[model samples]
Target: MWREPWPSSNRMPFTKKRKLQLSPEQCSDFYADQYGKFFFPSLTAFMSSGPIIALTLARNNAIAHWKSIIGPVNSTKARETHPECLRAKYGTSDLKNALHGSESFHAAEREIKFMFPNSVIEPFPSREGIEEYLSRYVNPTLLHGLTELCKHKPHNPCVWLADWLMKNSPNKPKICDGVTVEEAE
Candidate 1:
């Protein structure tokens, strides 16, 4: 139901896309938690009838913008009031409306999790955190490794550097968390 300015133009980009055919049970589970028992039967039936496309759009104020473009929940009202809206052209009635959009950012996150269980959703690292992580975990060791590579000038530089980094990385896991190498063996 959400529409945005063209992704190619850099307004909003589609971050994820999935094509899925839901079973009745799956559809029931998806909608029942939010819409409640009254609407679940018809909604689930309709949703499970065919393949559906789920998309994740990313940008600021995305939920509000999408709601504006999709118009009201009632397709008839949408046709009468906002003829340009997606429901006006594609929907049949209130429950049979052709598209679904998350009502809020939190709902978006929840719905995305339901649809894509394996996908990780989290806030981006802060600038300070990123800088600290780079300084502590990457910069000094990477600089030293690069200097060594430059001095050695190995014929297979990529492989040599990979081996060096693997061997020298401070973050590399030991044989056991608290045990010494001999104890672990």
Candidate 2:
């Protein structure tokens, strides 16, 4: 299923651009599993012929939305049906379609991995999960800190609260080996 990024947008939310020229062998390897044996060679040659821009688009239903904007695979068909589309406006034929979009979420993930090996794709957290995390780890500690701050009414409340939280935190590391200053009698 298509996974939308957190904080939904009406438009494309994120774009990462990579400019690279692929060798024919690299192109062949890239499309090996996607295209058939007969179609692979030409597709590889065309892809490797010049420099290409690889873009990663992130938003709600990005793949489907982009595909719609680019129009059909055949430029001639796109011209007839969707004259405003990128392929219709720029492409000359089916194989020479002006742009390519991932067919599905799986294809998108696969293509992204192939194109950007170093990149990390993270799944968005569910709303319930986020709420649960806050409730379990944050609310109690924050409540205590806020209550103490209100009671003490420190001159620099923000700093005071921060220091108080740090000092009172169960997660704070203990320094057992540190020298203690003895009180003067």
Candidate 3:
């Protein structure tokens, strides 16, 4: 999972005391009329009270897996029904559930764009095919290669990373196929 800075517009949804500043129409639109009116204020407040960390994760059936791990939307109910789930273990109540999972693949794509506007996420090949998806779409970049060292190899990792970055840094000029600024005209 990778962390991203929260969007500034999220702050407009609630008050300092964590009360929602939304109209009934807005609440319906946001929640898709799934939750009751009474819950909307607290739900919005909870979501907007502070900066939220956005994460990108990959796995077979990722959406379903993540939803299952988070359990029910109501944390108290999750604790009684799914004691092993993340919300059941860490959440205090429905209003304070600690995680959010996308409910569908389309929703996940849209949400990813909303959180990280410049992200380059490809459409999924198949929800059940993890290996094929990874091989086809998830090529290891310089950053990913360096990060993998901690898991696959840990000997002198810091030195290895420093050396790798020095070799790859764009500050050192190299021959290129594209036109330079001087030749563009």
Candidate 4:
């Protein structure tokens, strides 16, 4: 299912440049130290060369699913191996792959924070915990359009939630007492 794109466009002036330049040390910290300095400049240049999409997804094992679906970093290899994958079908070359997926949960969180500074995503939850939290808080708010209500009463979670549900519940259709159904002959 296609979800909404990033709230801000890549071409927008506010996002015209990379938010943080990864120093050689930082790059080593984030991406393994085995990658030499020679690789960093070209990688940075390629990344900054055009607009890129950042996705904020919520689901079980999203990192693994996305990485598998996109095939591999090298489009050519992906085409030869996983022809049905997204990169195999759409990617131009190894450097210009059609999509990017985080290597791990930590990487996903960092990338999401980098792309959307204002957004706050809690640490990844276990499958059971995620389902419970979604059922209790997230899904209801979305279904009832309680964003504004929550914003207004940010300090009081229960108040806005209760108000939102009470105001938005659907009315039942009136039933006729004398109506009876007959079995088909």
lDDT scores of the candidates, listed in order: 0.78, 0.76, 0.61, 0.61
> Which candidate number maximizes TM-score?
2
Residues 1-185 of candidate 3 have per-residue lDDT tens digits of 11124335323221112122444454345455456668776766555555555666676677887788678878899989999877787677676777677888878776666556687787656555876546544444355656766666767888877776666544455446874333221
Model 1 Cα lDDT, one tens digit per residue, 74-164: 9999999999877787788888877788887888888999888888887767789999999977998899999999999999999999999
TM-score of every prediction relative to native: 0.60, 0.64, 0.50, 0.52
lDDT of model 4, residue 64: 81
Candidate 1: segments with Cα more than 4 A from true spot: 1-12, 34-37, 124-185
Q: Could you give candidate 2's per-residue lDDT for residues 30-130 as a string of tens digits? A: 77785676767778888888887777888777888888877998999999999987778777777778678887788888888888888898876788998
lDDT of 4 by residue, 1-185 (tens): 11123333222222222333444444344444336666665555555544455556666677787778778889899999999877787778876667667877877777667666787787666789989978876686566666766467667777767766665543323335865434232
Clashes by residue pair, model 1: none
Q: Least lDDT summed over 10 consecutive residues: which range in candidate 1?
A: 1-10
Which regions of candidate 4 are displaced past 4 Å?
1-37, 124-185
Better of 2 and 3 by lDDT: 2
Output the better candidate (2/4) by TM-score: 2
Worst 10-residue lDDT window, candidate 4: 1-10
- In model 4, the clashing pairs are none
